[model samples]
Target: MLYKELVELYKRLEKTTLKTLKTKFVSDFLKSVEKPELLEVIPYLILGKVFPDWDERELGIGEKLLIKAVSMATGINSEEIENSVRDTGDLGESIALALNKRKQKSFFSQPLTIERVYNTLVKIAEASGAGSQDRKLKYLANLFMDASPDEGKYLARTVLGIMRTGVAEGLLRDALADAFKVRVELVERAYMLTSDFGFVAKVAKLEGDEGLAKVKIQVGKPIKPMLAQMAANVREALVEMGGEAEFEIKYDGARVQVHKNGNKVLIYSRRLENVTKSIPEVVERVKEALKPEKVIVEGELVAVEETGRPRPFQYVLRRFRRKYNIEEMIEKIPLELNLFDILYVDGQNMIDTPFMERRKVLESVVNSNEWIKSAENLITKSPEEAEAFYHKALDLGHEGLMAKRLDSTYEPGNRGKKWLKIKPTMENLDLVVLGAEWGEGRRSGVLSSFLLGAYDPVKGDFVPVGKVGSGFTDEDLVEFTKMLKPLIKKEHGKEVELEPKVVIEVAYQEIQKSPKYESGFALRFPRYIALREDKGPEDADTVQRLAELYQFQERLKGGR
Candidate 1:
C-alpha cells in the first residue's frame, strides 16, 4: 500500500475525537489492506513504531540526526530547521515545513510505499559500528529524498516514534474485533500471549477465533512479566487477597524471566529486553538446574555476598550495565536465583494454571540447590504467620513479601488484586532533592540545607515537603556538594534549584498538614538516612502516597 494513503488515514484519525468513528476509521483501514505481509506490520506502523515493543532495536535516530537529514533533503540550513522546530513544537511538522521549500526533487526519487519505508527503517535500526552513523544517515536521507511534504510529516514522526495516532492499543484492539468479527477478549488474550498486535491481527484476519485460541507461549519470546499492586502492610495484603494468601519473599533485586529450550537459556529483564549475554552465569545456572527441556520461569535474580545474603539491588544492576569483561564482574558479584512462578513447562501452557498449582510445578521441576531454589514461601490465613514470614524476609535481606491469591491465574502485564506487594512502612520517606541552599557557619562552601520533594507521578514532577540539613557528616556535605554542582538549574543568592536527580531517604517524626508546600504536608524533624542511589526520582515516594500514609497513621492513633 502507498505510504501516502496511511498518511491520509492519520489526517482523518487526527481530525476526530469520537471513539466509534475512530474505531471505524482504523477498522476500514485494516480491511482495505490487501497484502497479508502489509497487514502484519501496519498495526505497528500505525502506532508510530517500526517494530513491536519486545523487539529491542531502536531506530538510533535522534532529533539532531533527524534535523541533519531534513537539512540534507531540502537544502535548508540546520539553523532555520531548528528555529522552525522551536516555532512549531512538532518535530514532524518542522521537517515537513523545511521539505516544502525544496526547489526540486531528486532525479531518481520514487514514491514511498509502506513496505519500503518500513524496510528502510529496519535497515537504519540494524545499522551499527564503524561508519554505521553515516549508513543510518544515508538511509534516512534517501527516504526523506523521496517523501512528499505530506509524506515527510509522517515519515519524520515514524522514524522518531512520536506520531499522534488516535488509535491506541484499545482502539486498535476494538478495530480488529470490529473488522475481523473476533471477540475483543480473544484479541486481547492473544495480544497478551504474543505481545505483537500485528501478528495477532494477521492471525485473526486469516484464521479467525480458532487460530487466536491456538496462540500460546513461545519458549524464547519474552512474555510480559506480571506486576504487583502495593499494599501498605501484610494485614492489608491478606485482607485484599481474601484472608488466605500464598505469600512469598519479594527480594530487593531484579526480576527476570527465564526461558529454557534444552541446552539454551535466555533471560529477560522486567522491561522484557533480552539480557542473555550480560548474565551468562544465570544462563549456566538455569541450564544446569532446570530439568524440563522447554520451560519458562519467572524469578528474582539477586546479587549475593559470599555468605549467601543478597547484596544491594544496585550490585546486580552493575552486571547488567557491563558490556566488557563480564566474566570478572560475574565472579566479583555472584548472583542467586529464587524461582517463584512458572509460566510454561514442556509444551503445556501453564499461564492459566492456578497459582498454587504453578508453584507445585516449579518445585517439581527444579533441582534445588543453595544458590538457585524455590522461593521461601508460606501459605496462611493467620496474621501472625504472615507477619512472621514478612519479618523473616526482611531479616534475610529481602525488601518485602508478595501476597498472591491461591487460585489466581498468571496474567501477563496486569497488576491486579490477584497479587499484591507487602512492605512495612515507617514515618520515614524517600524523597528527591528539589533544590538546596548553601551552607553557613562551619560548612560555608556546600549545599547543606536541602529542599526535598515527594514525587507526584500524576504531575510528573516533585512536590516539596520540607527542607533537611541535619543528618549529614561534614564528609557527606562535601561529597554531596561535589555531586550536585553539575545539576544546578538556577541560582538566587545562597538558594539554587536542582534537577530533582538525587534521591534520599528521610526520616520524620510525623506528617502534619501544612500550607508551606504544594503537597500540603510537612515532615516534622526530618533527617536524612542515606542517598538512595538505587532509586530514581520516579521511584521516590508519591504525594498521594504520603497523604495515604498519613491517614493510615491517623487511623492507628484513633484506634489507640
Candidate 2:
C-alpha cells in the first residue's frame, strides 16, 4: 500500500471533528487492507508509530534537528524554516510550506510505500550513539524529498512524536471492532491486558473472538490499574458498595504494579512505565515479601521519613525523576510498599476473581515486614466504621479511605461505583488542561494560569471550566512549562491554545452555576493538586459529574 493512501485518510479524518465519521474512515481503511501483517501494522501507523508504548524506543529527533532536516530537503535555510514555524505555531505546517517551495527533485525517486516509510522510521528510532543524529537526519531528508507536501507534513509530525490528529485510543478500539466484526468489549479487554492494540488488531483479524479470549494476563506485562470514583461521604460509599464493604487506607504515594517471575521482579507505574530501575529497593522488598514464584500484585510505594512516617507525595515523586546517584537517593528517601490487590499468581489470571478472594490471596502470599506490608483495612457494614477509618488515614498523614465492594471483580481501567474514595474537605476532580496563559513577574517567561476543562461525552469535546493560577510551586511551573511546550497549538497574545491531553487533579472548595465557562459550571477556588499521569484526557471528569456535584453542594448548603 502507498503511504499517500494513509495520508489521504488522515486528511479525511482531520476534516471532521465528529468521532463517528473519524471511526468510520478508520474502519473503512482497515477493512480494505487484506494482509494480516499489514493489519497488524496499520494500527500503529494510525497512532503515528511503529513501536509499542512499552517498547522504550524513541525517534530522538528534536525541533532543531527537524528544522535542519527540512532545510536540507527543501534547500531552504534554517532561519526561513524556523521563522515559518514560529508564524504558524506548527512544525508540520512549516515543513509542508517548505516542501512546496522545493526547486529540484531527485532524478530517480520512488513513491514512498507504507512498508518503506515504517521501516525507515524504525531505523531512525533505532539509530544510536556516535553520529547517529546525522544518519537520522539523512534518512528523514531522503523521505521528505520523496514525499509530497501533505506527506511531508505528516512525516515531520510523526517523526517529532506530536501527531495532533486527535485520534485517541477509544477511536481505534471502535474502528477495530467495526472492521473485524468483533465486540468492543473483547477488543478493550485485550488492549487493557496486552497494552498493544496492534497485537489485538492482528489477533482479532486473524482468529476473531477466540483469539481475543486467549489473551491472558502475563507476569511481565503491565495491566492498566483499576481506578476509583469519588463518594460524597462514607454513607454514600457504603450504600454504593451494597452495605458490606472493605475500607482500605488510601495512601498518598505512587501506584505501582509489581510482577514477580521466579527471582526477578519488575515494578510498573500506574501509567504502565517500567520503574524497575528507579525503585530497586521496592523490587527487592517485594521479592522478599511475596512467596509466590510467579505473581502480579498492585500496591502503593510511599517515601517514608527517618521516623517511618510517610513523606509528602511531591517528595516521593523525586525518586521517579532521579537519574543519577540512585543508591544515594534511595538511602536518603527510603520507600515502603503497601500491597492491596493481587491480579495473578502461579499461572492463574486473577482479574476475574472477587475482591475478597484477591485480598485473601494477597495476604496469604505476602509476609509482613517493616518496609513491605498489606494495606491497613477493615471489613465494615457500618458507615461509622468507614468514617473512622477515613479519619485514621488522614491523621496518619495519608489520603482518605477507599471503600470497595467485596464481590466486585478487578476491572482494569474502569472507574465505577464498585470502588469509591472518600476524602475530607471538598472532593477532587480529574480535569484536562486545555490552554494556559503566559506568566508575569517571577514566572514571566513560563506558562501559568491553566485553562481547565471537563469532558462532554455528548459533544465528544472538552468543555471549558475555569482558569487556575494557584497551588503550583516554582518547580511545578518549570516542569509544566517543559511538558506543555510541545503541545502548544496556537499563540494568542497572553494565552496559548493547546491540545487537551494532560490530566490534572484539581481541588476546589465548591461548584457554582456560571455562564462564564462553556461547561455552564465553574469551580470555586480551584487549585491544582497534582498531575495525574495515570489518566488521559478521556478519563477526565464529565460535565454531567460537575452538574451533579453542584446540585449536591446546593443540597448540603440548604441542609446547613
Judging by TM-score against the true structure, name the best candidate. 2
Candidate 1, residues 128-177: lDDT per residue as tens digits?
88999999988898888898888998888777665655456667898999
The residue pairs in collision within model 1 are none
| Overall lDDT per candidate, in order of appearance | 0.84, 0.86
Error of 1 at 552 (Å): 8.0
lDDT of 2 by residue, 1-560 (tens): 99999999889987899989988999999988887887767897897766765565678788899888878887899899899887888888888999999866888889998888988888998999899989999998889889899999988877766677767788899999999999999999998997888789999899899999899887887888788877778898888888899999989888888889999998777777676877778878878899999999999888989877788765667787676799999999899889999999999989999999999999999999999999999999987777878888999999888889999999998877898878776578989999999999999989989999998877768889998999999999999998887789988898999888899999888898899988999988999999887566766888988976786677557743
The TM-score of predicted model 1 comes to: 0.75
TM-score of 2: 0.91
> Could you tell me how far off, in angstroms, the CA of residue 156 lies in candidate 2 after the best superposition?
2.0
